[model samples]
Target: MNNNKILDVAIVGYGPVGQTLAILLGRMGYNVAVYERWQALYPLPRAVFHDHEIRRVFRMMGLENELEKVSQPSACYQWFNADWKVLVEIDWSAESISDGPFGYLFNQPSLEAILDRQAKAIGNVQVHQGWEVLGLSQNDATCELNMRKVEGDGAGETRTVQAKYVIGADGANSIVRRECGIEWHDLGFDEDWLVVDLQPNAGVELDVPDIGQWCNPARPTTMVPGGPGYRRWEFMRLPHESVEDLQSTEKVWQLLSPWVTPETASLVRHAVYKFRSRIAEHWQQGRILLAGDAAHLMPPFMGQGMCSGIRDAWNLSWRLDLVLKGICSEELLNNYTTERKPQIQAVIEASMAMGKVVCVADPQAAAERDAKFLSGQVPPLPPFPGLEQGLVFKTAKAGVSGSLGIHGAIERNDKVERFDDAFGRGFFLLSIGEDPLQSLDEKLLGELNQLGVRSVRLSKDGAPGTCRDVSGKYHQFFEENQLQAVLVRPDFYLYGGVSTHSEIPALVQSLCDEVSLKREPCAQLSQAKVAVR
Candidate 1:
């Protein structure tokens, strides 16, 4: 309705990814507009899992309690052979760097509903449901989105909206991506599977493995939680089976009968999906960018599809904020692709590896795979990849840059809580047994202050301006790494760390350089002050 008013960001798509970007940007007091073709939530399950890192992001959004109520922590993910013998087990229940369970299971619709409410409640965000993005174009200054209303009283109405930036959080078949002429690089992993979501009847319990994969050559299968009050089963289609036949309700029941009878559970939804791996050749072009499924898609074997998209939102949010606020150059956005694409590609490859192990249809190959695992000859699962190549200090101590920053409980104001909750979250400069700011001169401190970097000191004595590390995790991390200070990015990844307090200034300066912070403005202000003096 307000075509003349330019927005800071225009988001195309109102799914979880779009909603997340809107909420993140809006919370920073940016003018954000979201356009979605659907008038209402899908109200069904799609993505059923998220990791603790995503949980940390939700906590930053102030949704920790709401998420806890609607989601359940995952159990070990076990893989079995044709005879139901355990081949490999992954502990998804273990604690992670985010100070929570490694993984969780929840209904996508419920999570989206929560995010939708949060996004709409923000005064600066406008959510236009049923408005389809027809096309988008961007120049040096701004991007314009052409949209048409497809629902409600103003059906078929067209309007154009302008914004400083445009994000395509649209799904795999993204119109915005197409409009930008972006192409997808297929990773060659493709398979057809029947996905069935079921809600067990109240007061009835079904005996089933919590979360597992049955690598049977006869009929490879997957069973996992479908959020709080549901269950999901996926059956890989054998080479001889047709997609149409596998999608029938009768066939779905047959595949599910081994776990639950129709009388004991109700079928909520059943469909055939082609799980594939794909990545956009480029995620950004001038003022237009892609996030979530629009940027990449991986097999659901590792349960990182939605998680990766949400990571894009989190990673892009801070960068966009800095650029919008004029604190950094637009070139900072290029890091979004460099930092995220490699991580996403790694995830796709990892997921494909898992899919290959479980998608075997040949009896002889399946037997060989089982033998390798059961004989204790197979290597363990590789650890998840971290930020490797973007916006991180390259010359810092080994194993510090690009790794996840440590978090632990701390005592503040006589109350013990998570470190982030106590110290606040932002670009953090943390030190052990000393004040990191003490090493910086007035000019460097002023620049860091202008960037809103929070300086915190962790100590055992609980000094006036320092937080007490109640959990000892901080002390252990500092002692083992022989580090006195570390600079953490907003997304909780280490930009770099210093072994001594004197190195703090260089570390801080590196961040300023990486973000391309314009010191000329600050220098001009300083000169003006001196001239007055």
Candidate 2:
């Protein structure tokens, strides 16, 4: 064996995003390292709003069952005004598909803890908590890095490392972005806010079950249940008013006094922050890249800030895995930033719009905005437009050529990674039970196994009537639900399918050039099922 080495990946700045990228790539058998500035973890609840793709990440990481334990079943939600007037009190349990409104609410610390533990569990990720990246640059061959332990009262020692690629998941003030000369567009957030998380009283009167929001013009509050009696109420600070002396218990009680008795509210985590919107002009330069808060920063209006970064992790994870495995050309990795940037920008715009509506304290604007929805002129916000739902995105820039329109932007994460017997390649296809990876001929199945294609045949357990599998595929029971097996590609796209078993190999070949997948599928596709549904 040649002693000389080829660098796989080096991830700079080991926060949640960096850590997540390391874990994801490590799972795909890529060599990864996470460099962090802090010697220890930050004990703050940085992110709270957990969404759909987040749940999918947990599922992919084999932590879904564990996450389901701490996860409180948040089904009922109420959108009310200061007068306790109901506007949109949606029982999320009713809407589980397409846009599954019912999800979990855990602080960023808890979620990060899970990801960190899982990354350690992968056993391949080397973590350097106190090491700060000195600098980075890349060429066509590989990327280089400089590092040192954060300086103490004495002086810090220096170190150097190299890798094939570098991901800068550092926060908004990213050093790697500076190295790459990446520009960012700023959405002015001259206004700032205070978040006062408090506990609820025993006999407080409100119709909200677990998660609720007070959408009053003055002092809007969101009641997010953390655990048993503790609830979070994020209060937007008024103009010219900084959250001075907010750490004191008295001040917290005073700010929340209008809503409830001071004795009833307990201040758990209280702080102030200026909300801003910014997306990095470019996400990658040569082998150096950026992710998470480093690439895009959005206000916490919809709680998708970290969620969007997690989405980035999901998108880039498999692609990097493919390149490292020599399954896909490294050029395909260039599509990583291309595919994700526009989507994240759209998310930022949506979040900014939501912030305007949610933070509108002016009576006239609030009434006009709320009245349209109250009067039923416009439908209640569809719980964040999703891939399956109607999606609108920002147009691509000049030279960003492709036949695929915004669909590529919105639907990128829609495809599932199914893992079963026939599938090879480290990534799973994520299929439904009914369309379980069809029992192919032994020779073909063995060939896939030899090629090491990782696949899964999911049986949607306890799915009522008929439902799609985890891979967004159809199984034997798919007829009732109008689904056939959706063949999800390694990059997590619906590669074809919606037909049946035997027919998959041909369909797979056309979608991904991994193997000799034929065009003519063996399984018969039901046309009547399509027309009926």
Candidate 3:
């Protein structure tokens, strides 16, 4: 460990979350050091799915082409009864506001390999594999990590690394979380399930099953397509079955007998996992913070476990960058846990609801559920919830305040690119028909500029320094929501919006107060009433 100078940020665990944070912070020109216990990439596939928001993050990282090579769009997810009757269906194939597929399935090992390569290519990123974090202590100024080279030539040797901040992306049993003394709260969900992976043989004529959940009283199971020809099956362990009993090759074959035979498909891997739902009481403690699995864990029912972790990485990186650059007060860090906790809780609740639907073992109850669906009456899927708290502005349409900022393609240099590329990074104030910079008073515009807000006027015709709204979704979105302008946070979340230009000052001031940004000379608000809805 190099202790000559205090580094900007030190990340524990070099998994996808850690690697993503490293790449992001490196791009922000921060010195990043990542320590992981694993000497090499875990060869097995774990998380195999991510949504379009994550795809946008990949685009920001300039790895969209590489990501496309190892991923394929997911089909609609359907649920069925024991007799193969449809209970419910979720259309995952719909185009997202981000102008991309809503969901994608990929090979995790391949994706991690690409992330590792890209992270290593960054000049400011240093990855230290086979290093174990034994202890951590932090003061107001810096955090010190005690680590040991647990493998190869320097085995058993100890060293210390100092950093301004440290992040724990080290999976479920995070040492950083433990050292911070954060308590883990179980969300009252625990189940044992056997997951099996398969690869069909060439020239096999059998049709592969579509992605779906089989909610049977006899044996609840799920089947989802992997990348390309790969497939996955998950079967719940009954009360009578022990972990030992399910681990037997014969029992595994008996479970898969209905789907494939040794002749048609080959077994890739099988493991019994105790799917659980747990979240930490808090995500931050002093200079040490938690992200990814260190902060929360959910059952794979909704396929948001890894996606949530990736979101955590993205959320934390931008906030850390702002704080490190002196653009915001350290108190801004408090909003991270305040914002992410509720969003993750909502995800957990949704996942648990899906779990309850799948884990039904009562014959009569399962029949009743099947009847409810077969009667041409099915519960509508819940809308995706936004952040319930944090740096959101209080206004007439508060619901959309904490929600994600929508994205669309814009014509740039005779080519189309996503809005982020054209608008540039950092806080963005985008207006539909008027120029926010020109309309905003100089006092407000100067303060906003000082806070690093980029003003862009979205127009119909392609013009230099203007987003063209190529898909027309931007104009439609504003028209539908009755919004004339929207302030987009750097993390791509809606900070606020206003229907009239007169409302800009109050909203910007509120945002500055939310982030604890101090203005040199505070401007007075207008007495005129402004409608933000």
The TM-score values for the models, in the order shown, are: 0.96, 0.75, 0.94
lDDT of 2 at 163: 84
TM-score of 3: 0.94
Q: In candidate 2, what are the lDDT values of residues 293-361, reduced to their tens digit?
A: 989999876668887887777667776765666645666667666667776777788778767766767
Top lDDT hit: 1
> How far is 203's C-alpha from truth in model 2 (Å)?
11
In model 2, state the lDDT of residue 397. 20
Query: Cα lDDT of all candidates, in order?
Result: 0.88, 0.60, 0.84
Instruction: Report the candidate with higher TM-score, 1 versus 2.
Output: 1
Q: Is candidate 2 or candidate 3 better by lDDT?
A: 3
Residue-wise lDDT of candidate 1 within 124-191, one digit each (tens)? 99999999987788788989888999998799899999999999998999999999899999999999
Q: Residue 189 deviation, candidate 3, in Å?
A: 0.5
Candidate 2's C-alpha runs over 4 A off are 1-7, 90-101, 151-155, 187-190, 198-209, 227-229, 243-249, 258-266, 382-485, 490-493, 496-509, 513-533
Off by over 4 Å in 3: 376-378, 412-414, 461-466, 518-533
How much is the lDDT of residue 247 in candidate 2? 53
Q: Which TM-score value belongs to model 1?
A: 0.96
Clashes of each: 0, 33, 0
- Top TM-score model: 1
